[model samples]
Target: MVQTFLPHPPGARLALEDATRARTGSPVQMGLDELGTPLSQTTFVVVDLETTGGSPTSSEITEIGAVKVRGGEVLGEFQTLVDPGSPVPPMITVLTGITDAMLVGAPRIGEVLPAFLEFAQLGAGTVLVAHNAPFDVGFLRAAADRMSLPWPRVQVVDTVKLARRVVTRDEAPNNKLGTLAALFGATVTPDHRALHDARATVDVLHALLARMGPLGVTHLEDLVTASDPVPHQRRRKSHLAEHLPGGPGVYQFLGPRREVLYVGTAVDIRRRVRSYFTAAEKRRRIGEMVDLAEEVRAVPCTTALEASVRELRLIAEHDPPYNRRSRRPERRPWVRLTDEAFPRLTIVRQVTPDDDAIGPFSSRRAAEECVEAIQEAFALRRCTPRLPRLARAGASACVLAEIGRCGAPCTGAQDVPSYAVVAGAVRACLREDAEPVVAAVHARIATLAVQERFEEAAVQRDRLRSFLVAARRTQRLRPLWRCPELVAARRAADGGWELVLARYGRLAGTCLVPRGVDPMPAVEALVATGEVVAAPTTAMGAASSEETELLADWIEDPATRLVRWDESDTPLACPVRGAARHAVPARG
Candidate 1:
């Protein structure tokens, strides 16, 4: 049977239950009020344990002490000597001042653990406090495991972790229990015994609490989050994540009028969004975005990649104020193969219906660099603007012809039929075979090296690398765009497969296969229920380059596994001999 106790002054012993309460109607409700429970109202069980050794698995607890407090009043205290069922090492005996003889007739851990659990009120609204909690808790858990007893699910506060966040090195020499105990001027000094050390930790706890108040640490969650020290703006928006579900998904921060301010993905949305309100969130723009956020909305996805795709799509659609890359595909430059008799490689902001485009490159400068590399690699016509057949036949060859950079197509010197051979090589390079262009660039680099133009050769080498990187990126992604319909699956982080269906290169459906379950049913259900977003119908849709490029990017990730494609005759796979492998810097 458990004995009842009432709150009392510091160092006061537990009071006996009143006999008058037996005559009363019912047992008085002992719970504290729920609305914003103050630190004064919340009970703290400051705990300390003396163990035979550090490793809980190999060691055993020799003694345990805890002081229960509420509003700084001593509610109760528990102290016990435990029979560890093992020999105490000599060093442990010297350090803790505990010996095997003292525990000769003490209660075993099985009897001690349950009684201590009851005394500490191990349930909701109660928090466990310790100087170095992990050490004590580890032993407690080990004892519980040994007895086949369930450890209480209680919130634990490590004063050491808290002290590091709140106390500066200048204020305290170190965060050790003894140093902090003396620094805070506790009522009892810690002397290796359990109860005395617990009393000291209580004083340190109150000192840290006082320091935390000025720093806007009000709620328990705030107190816990203070350990990381996130941006100041994050604290003001802590309520934004109050209702977010903890799951894999995309989260959108919305401004006034429901305008999206930012879009992101997280394996655990609640934790990720709450992290923004902590000091650990260091992104400068995201901090500003959090300040502007009025509401947050979470959309759960089947897998991380699905969440990633959804985030990218939302970012593309809303062009959220804080998002930087992948926001405006229309503005991103593409490598355009002009539809002229003597076609020239050029970088354009948008792809036209008639143009044979190769990119939705990251930037205009990058696209220009790729065009330059391709021009160096192949003898494509270097003339700008459309070249008429008649004009090309009459025009004089430029000085570039003397350097062998071009086939002199502006003049009749190189006939259209003869020049088509080099043009065919350019076409093949753009379509898939990047080997010819890569080889040409290598040859040029070697020639420049032979001429002792090392700096120029380095520039050529960098250009070749840039060209190959872009070519490989586009090459990897191009097939996903070309396919009419596709089904693919990739292992989700949660030990399941994430299935995705695309129609005309746009995401049509997605679903998850729970662990240990067949995925085919979910895949069929998703395909049946999912909506096919119509592709852009303007010159944009005619290009089919941007959407396809995005799809290719998602598919290129090594984790993604393709299950099916619409064109069975044309399987979707990486090119056997593409520029991807050629771009690697050779080992010396």
Candidate 2:
């Protein structure tokens, strides 16, 4: 997702240069500010294609025409006839005034496509415009793909969509190229030929943009967004995003009683929050969520990672009605080593204080895979929950026990003292010492491959990879538990720094330092106002692995600089030989 954010302050409208500078260091930030890019600076490529027939798959490009312009001045032009490699239909010839003789010696589509692509991308940033964008762009993409050429990543604008949004039917009879050209009094009229139609569409594009100027559609992104039709009822509530800050932050949609409806994070809170009310919002449930929302709230953060972590925390805290995922944290399954006489591995939701838990995995299946990998490493009991206290004297043993895959404590075939060593090794593997389990899994994978059971081997490989990822994540985060205070800084776009302070892995306070500002006073003020977060008492809520991982990611970002810490040494460092790093190899 290409997330967008405004600059430093949340509520202030920024000048183009200022907004650009503010978002410089952040990767997710993109130009969405209404006035960020001037109309005069943008390049527009008006394109039109006369194809053999309707479908690009069946029909081929008969002619290609385009005009490049910037600030109303035509910079260059492209026009070509393509040998479509098929007979041009009589109906298409009558409509476009191009016949077989006209294209007799013209370059084929394969030869024409590359030159067309180069022409379309003549400017630093180009937006392709057409009467009906999909038709022209579709044919171009189809022809390019047939030649095994990569399609250009250019923004496309449809004059039809633009006219539907900006001009009422009362002003224009209909949204056809000819009708629109006459209605807008365009000097160049559509003559059905590619070049003439493209020129006419160019005029229509300018006309639509002129109509959009009053709606605050100054930047290219703003223009594209405005072209989307928004629900009338929803448009009235767009005021909720009017004052949202432009920087990285989490935003919440609130209901009548200040209840959180949906929680989301964005690099540009205003742009993202405002999108919920637009026609581009296709999710039916989200439209329903917006209908219930009475207000929108913004909480600023220093970086994209911080926004993500804050979103997780907020979702967990509120368990909001509209939020479907991450709201029910208790529902996320974890792989736990049961605290019974035969300590078998199990997939569980509720985490008791005595249980050793590995994760709040995305699903029960993932947690099951982790447990299966651990069991494969050590022949732990694979019986159903709560096995007979001493195993029924004459009970039947399952195939797993017969195959030596399980210790078979359920059938009295294995004793508790003997099982203890396997369970202990499993615990060791789940914690830091993962070599024993890794080697065992590698051997199993090798044996399965030797037996030509490649599918089963792939499954085992994934399982082992899952266990290693969780175990390494836990080990890397273990040190943060001992630290009382942690503080770090990331450089801002304007030569300043943003500060983050956490106490015992919980975010406490944040402050920003402009390039030359004194840091001491602001630091003191921030710490004084910072809230003291209490540690989680429940095993399910312990450590908030998601937040810790987010923090670790933020700390590791190259833009950040360590400012101050209450501890003598920073415990947050990436492990050199961690299993997580070793699990995947870089492809050449």
Candidate 3:
């Protein structure tokens, strides 16, 4: 039989009880203020179980007890004993006072599970609460699976986890159910009986709920995640996320003076921004950023890809203090062929339309390493001074000529045509073909290893790897940069079409077509209204290399379909494969 009680007398309301009741409506509301159902209106089914063993696999449920309550009022209760299909262990019987003889006519788990599930009302927005939830829930889930009974998905709250967050060590020895029951002055004393223990847990649940108000946990969602306590300072700033839309977008945390402190992208802007003020955000730097943030601004987009591209662009534009990556696009180094009588590979901070370049390497050090690799593979001139088109009469070669590392065009020893051959090879390696350079470096590494010069071989291997990786990136990006415009579509996770228009390796526009709708109209509209990206004057393209790389990744996805391609002399393709096979040195 079900028992009932009212923990709070009529008209005796707690601090936030009235406010919580007024705001309690639909749990599906997306506003930060309306975060799930208010705790006052949430139905909590406090459950406890007596088991034959600790593990669900080896153990069986001996009894089940639960009390369903809402607004400090008991709605109902469930209590039942189960025959474990075997004699109870003496140790378990001694702990719970249930002996083998007591299970003679008790119903089996299959017969009792349906009634208990009905009492809990698990499918209709009711939450399941337990002291140590995993143990009790694990046993029930295992029993249901064994009987082939469908288990409804339900939100579970663990009082043990909640008490640890709310009740300090000074107030309670530990977060054990018995200790918490005593600390909260529970009316029912637990004596290992399922119904009695579940009764004690109801008082503990209400007492814990009363203490959570000052911690800014008024909603049922907040209470479930209360174990990860949010600082009072961060919790106060949660209102900043209230107005943000619940959609794919880019969000910027603005400082007191409205300066961007951090930029991020998320599929759900409201939920993701709200996480910054919670324990979900564990980065110390971001935590500090949140403390200083005065407002949050969102830029909604149609698809996740657009959000990602917008995030990269915003990061580059603001160079926010908290963002470390993709902040300074201008500072990225590139390895390019300098235009001169004898062109040499030089690391530059910028790339021009006339230049043939291979990078946008991560740093100047990496660019230098790539240049060293190219020099090791070819006889390109290393001299910094530009030589005359015709070799001068009094020119003298540097020590590099004696070592035969350079063609020595400065000494008039090597004519313009011979030097041109070397410069052309370097250009080809940078722009068109990387195999010759890769092969030359691989051969050098093999020869070094044969002579027991393993260290030198390893250095050659590293140099080649740097060059090949940069070459592969450049080869992949160049085609997209040269293409005037390309439109593509792919099936999204929601069974809809994701249409994108890219111009000169930059994301011009994106649109999402609903599942049952024809996407051709959306594709046409996207292309018509997209940004008009002009032909890039520089090899770096209209967008930053990082932005271009993001676009390239989307275009190269196997599931993406190319709807249209307006090529500019070069088709979209990577001519050379990666150098992973040749990157390792041969061991002696």
Q: What's the distance in Å from true for residue 354, model 2? A: 7.2
Backbone clash tally (model 2): 8
- Model 1: colliding residue pairs: 229-279, 230-278, 230-279
Q: Write out the backbone clash pairs for model 2.
A: 4-267, 4-268, 5-246, 5-267, 5-268, 6-246, 6-247, 10-245
Candidate 1 Cα misplacement greater than 4 A, ranges? 1-194, 206-224, 231-233, 255-258, 352-354, 391-394, 448-454, 489-497, 513-525, 533-564, 568-570, 581-588
**1-588 in candidate 3: lDDT tens per residue?**
111111122366332213223333334356544354677888999999998999989989999999999999999989989999988899998899999898889999999998998788796568899989999999999999998999998988898888877788899889887898889899998888899999999999899988877776776656656777667777767767765677787889889888889999999988798888778889999999999999887776667888888789789878899998988987888999988877888889888866888888887877887898888878888878888877878888888788989878887788888888988888877877777778788789889999999889888877776787788778878878888889998898888888878888888887777788888777777777777788888887788888888888898899999999987577987765433223433323
Model 2: per-residue Cα lDDT at residue 109: 83
Compared with the true structure, all predictions reach lDDT values of 0.73, 0.74, 0.81
| Candidate numbers, best TM-score first, in rank order | 3, 1, 2
Q: Candidates' TM-scores?
A: 0.68, 0.64, 0.84
lDDT, ranked from best to worst: 3, 2, 1
Number of the top-ranking candidate, with lDDT as the measure: 3
Candidate scoring better on lDDT of 1 and 3: 3
Q: Candidate 3 — which pairs collide? A: none
Candidate 1, residues 1-588: lDDT per residue as tens digits? 111111122355221122223323245442323113457777899999999888998888999999999888889999999999988899999998788899899999999999999898777878898989999999998888888989889989899988987788998989998999888888899998999999899999999988877665655666656666564456757767755656577888888777889998999887788778777678898888887888887776655556666677678878898988768867777776776677778887766433566666777776776787788777787778565565433477777888887777666667667777777777677767888767777898899999999888877777676677667766665555555667777776668777777765666666667677888777666666665445443223422344455566667679888776776534576677677667554312
Superposed Cα deviation of residue 304, candidate 1 (Å): 2.8
Task: Judge candidate 1 at residue 370 and give its lDDT.
Answer: 76
Q: Between candidates 1 and 3, which one is better according to TM-score?
A: 3
Q: What TM-score would you give candidate 3 relative to the actual structure? A: 0.84
